[model samples]
Target: MKAIKSFSIGLIFFVVSSCGSLNPINPLSLLMGNSWALSSLMGKSLDLSQFADGVPSLNFLEGGKLAGFTGCNNLSGSFALEGSSIRLDPGAVTRKACPGTGEQDFLGALSKVGNLKIGKDKLTFLNGEEELMSFIPKED
Candidate 1:
């Protein structure tokens, strides 16, 4: 009886310790697994799957960095997260001109995001009470 109790306690400890900080249950893991493409911008709907080129996408990299394509430019920036709040700083972006690309507007909306809401297959960036950008997980 004594040995069984010890083994049970040891098993529980091992299970709990294995789930430490890097567990898949962490929200960041769920957010990072998919690169998200813009579904809408400032209430204007867009379907990125239909676009032949210049499809904007967003990725949340590890180590508090955000990197993605801005339809025409590659952008990388630091992101601040506090509890449920988030802010994606407008970082460096290549300035090569791509006429008719919505790079500026896309980056603009990202900079304004004050929080992020993750749904089943969508990511919504919000500024205060307004939805600034909407995205759906992009296919691998």
Candidate 2:
């Protein structure tokens, strides 16, 4: 009887400690060579193409350097992972501004991103708790 109680307590402790492992992987780690689409803009979900020319791309190299497309133009930025939150810095990009509402909208969305989420097989950018963009892993 005492053995059963001890085993139960040990099982509970193991489960609790492992819970943090389920939090999810860093989004930047999953962003490598992945093309991410804007699922929700500002705070709503709409056809991303309704305001953009192409799906944004995310590429991570051997090092920590990061680069991607901003739908309108190409951008390169540095990123760091803290637990599960992926943080992006103000990146340098092509100065030739893209025309049309889509380009403008894409650029605007990038500005509002705070952190990112990486799931088992997808990635997302968050504005507070709301998801702004989500990306699926692409086949190389």
Identify the leading candidate in terms of lDDT: 1
TM-score of each: 0.73, 0.63
Model 1 residue 91 lDDT score: 85
Q: What would the per-residue lDDT of candidate 1 be over residues 1-140, giving only the tens digit for each residue?
A: 99999999999999888878553344476577889888899878864543335678888888888888877778888887775588887588877776653666777788788987776687888998899988899887
Q: Give one digit per residue, the lDDT tens place, for model 2 in 1-140.
A: 99999999999999999997795454445566465554555555555555345665666655666677766677787777666566665378766556556556655666666777676566777778976666666555
Best by TM-score: 1
Q: Which stretches of candidate 1 lie over 4 Å from their true place?
A: 1-26, 47-52
lDDT of 1: 0.78
Question: Which 10 consecutive positions of candidate 1 have the poorest summed lDDT?
Answer: 46-55
- Taking all chains together, the TM-score of candidate 1 against the true structure is 0.73
What number of backbone clashes does candidate 2 have, counting pairs of residues 3 or more apart or in separate chains?
1
